[model samples]
Target: AAGVIQSPRHLIKEKRETATLKCYPIPRHDTVYWYQQGPGQDPQFLISFYEKMQSDKGSIPDRFSAQQFSDYHSELNMSSLELGDSALYFCASSVGGGGETQYFGPGTRLLVL
Candidate 1:
């Protein structure tokens, strides 16, 4: 049983820098989502892609962007790093359409100094 995989389990950055996080969804899963969780805060949906197309957008900042690939993996691009941006970035995957049950990855912990 495979699950979503995210690279660079942890990251460190300075304010004003940029970082790119990678995600590999479960096989056959067509939907990939990105979420950001600040300390003691609930996970916030950032963006999602279905079948390689942008499907939904949430509180993602203008300085951030994401995309799903042909293989169903996804990437989150973050820029203008700020201390407030430090958090756990999670990647979740689901099969079929939106509303389907999703499974999340371990998450990438980003720290801005």
Candidate 2:
């Protein structure tokens, strides 16, 4: 019953700072995705990787980037943070191509002050 794992469950940052969030997907899963949820908003897809290659892109901002590793873990990098950037960031993993059931990790709550 292993699921996705995310680090630094919560983060506090000042304007213009940077933050990196990490995600470890379940074993054997090959597709990873990132999502961001702002206050009173639904989770929006940022990007996704399949088999270590960039597979899709969504609403991710220019100030952000992401990648997946050989072990299938992924990292989302955000920079020049702004107050509006505060939100819940989480990652999900699926078995193969997208459309499969994805398992999500506990979100990382980010706050900008």
Candidate 3:
């Protein structure tokens, strides 16, 4: 399997702006997950999608959202981003279920000014 892939590698945004990041998971994978890892902090779960439907969501604000395509690719959208949103956003994937080990991508580092 090819695992997961994310783009931009890095991003810089001013407060109240919007940012869109992308992710593509290995073929045949049924689940895609998103997470946020801020400086000096562990990765925080953002959301998960299975079969193109959201299966779970974490404590992220409304400014954060995601979508899954038929090909198992996904995108994370942040609206009116704030300084607090600056972090490394990681996209991961696994077969559907909660106990499996997720494979992650290199991540897109977002720097909100």
For each candidate, give its TM-score against the true structure: 0.97, 0.97, 0.94
Model 3 C-alpha lDDT per residue in residues 1-113, reported as the tens digit of each score: 47688998999999999999999987777899999999999999999999899999997789788999989899999999889999999999988756288999999999999
Cα-based lDDT at residue 104, candidate 3: 94
Error at 113, model 3, angstroms: 1.3
Over 1-113, each residue of candidate 2 has an lDDT whose tens digit, in order, gives: 99899998999999999999999999999999999999999999999999999999999999999999999999999999999999999899998876579899999999999
Q: Where is model 3 more than 4 Å wrong at Cα?
A: none
- Model 1 stretches astray by more than 4 angstroms: none
- The alpha-carbon RMSD values of the candidates against the true structure, listed in the order shown, are 0.8, 0.8, 1.2
What is the number of residue pairs that collide in model 2? 0
- Residues 49-84, candidate 1: write the lDDT tens digits: 999999999999999988888998999999998899
Error of 1 at 26 (Å): 0.6
Question: What is candidate 2's local distance difference test score?
Answer: 0.94
Over all chains combined, what TM-score does candidate 2 have? 0.97
Scanning candidate 3 in windows of ten residues, the lowest lDDT window is 93-102
Model 2 bad stretches (over 4 Å): none
Residue pairs that clash (backbone atoms under 3 angstroms), model 1:
none
Reference-based lDDT, residue 64, model 1: 95
The Cα local distance difference test for each model comes to 0.94, 0.94, 0.90
